[model samples]
Target: GAGVSQTPSNKVTEKGKYVELRCDPISGHTALYWYRQSLGQGPEFLIYFQGTGAADDSGLPNDRFFAVRPEGSVSTLKIQRTERGDSAVYLCASSSFGTGRVRNEQFFGPGTRLTVL
Candidate 1:
């Protein structure tokens, strides 16, 4: 199976708009995750999913940020009322085993760059 893939390599939007970023994890991967990276900073975890449910979403900054992995494969990160502070690279990752339980490394996508004005 292929590694994770994120659509729309780059996106630019005005403030207050809505945006959806997509991620397709490798086949058979049960664990999926989303992260945000700002310049000069490490990637920050946003949400994690096991199968069709979110196992952890504590890192999501606010209610305006959300993600879904309904089919346990393809996932989408939804952002509402976008702001300049939201500008960053959105990344998606996956592993064959669930987090905190597997010693295997997670595979990462190239990331989707989002810029808000």
Candidate 2:
């Protein structure tokens, strides 16, 4: 079975530019998550979607970051006014419920590395 996938594996842009990163989760996954990882640091949770609506966006630093999963399958992360500090690997993961009400393991994509110069 196929896992999660992200497009434009690497992106290079200048400060103030806008960028959009896309993610395709595994089929039948009802929970999707977005995270950002910087050098020498663990991934920081950004936003999460239980379905079409964002369940938690508290991790978003400010007004510059946003994400959406309209169809509950594919998601897109939008960044505005990119800054050098925004350079990092954007990761996407998805999970679902398993038997006995347990939570399934979250499968992660390779991620899109964005470099802002």
| Model 1, span 1-117: residue lDDT tens | 567899999999999999999999989889899999999999999999999999899999999999998889999999999999999999999988655465867899999999999
Query: Where is the poorest 10-residue window by lDDT in model 2?
Result: 96-105
Q: Estimate every model's Cα lDDT from 0 to 1.
A: 0.94, 0.92
Model 1 spans > 4 angstroms off? 98-100
**Worst lDDT 10-window in candidate 1:** 96-105
**Could you tell me how far off, in angstroms, the CA of residue 66 lies in candidate 1 after the best superposition?**
0.7
Q: Number of the top candidate by lDDT?
A: 1
Query: Which regions of candidate 2 deviate over 4 angstroms?
Result: 100-104
For 12-99, candidate 2 gives per-residue lDDT tens digits of 9999999999999989888989999999999999998998999899999999999989999999999999999999999999987656
Residue 56 lDDT in candidate 2: 93
Superposed by TM-score, candidate 2 places the C-alpha of residue 30 at a distance from the truth, in angstroms, of 0.6
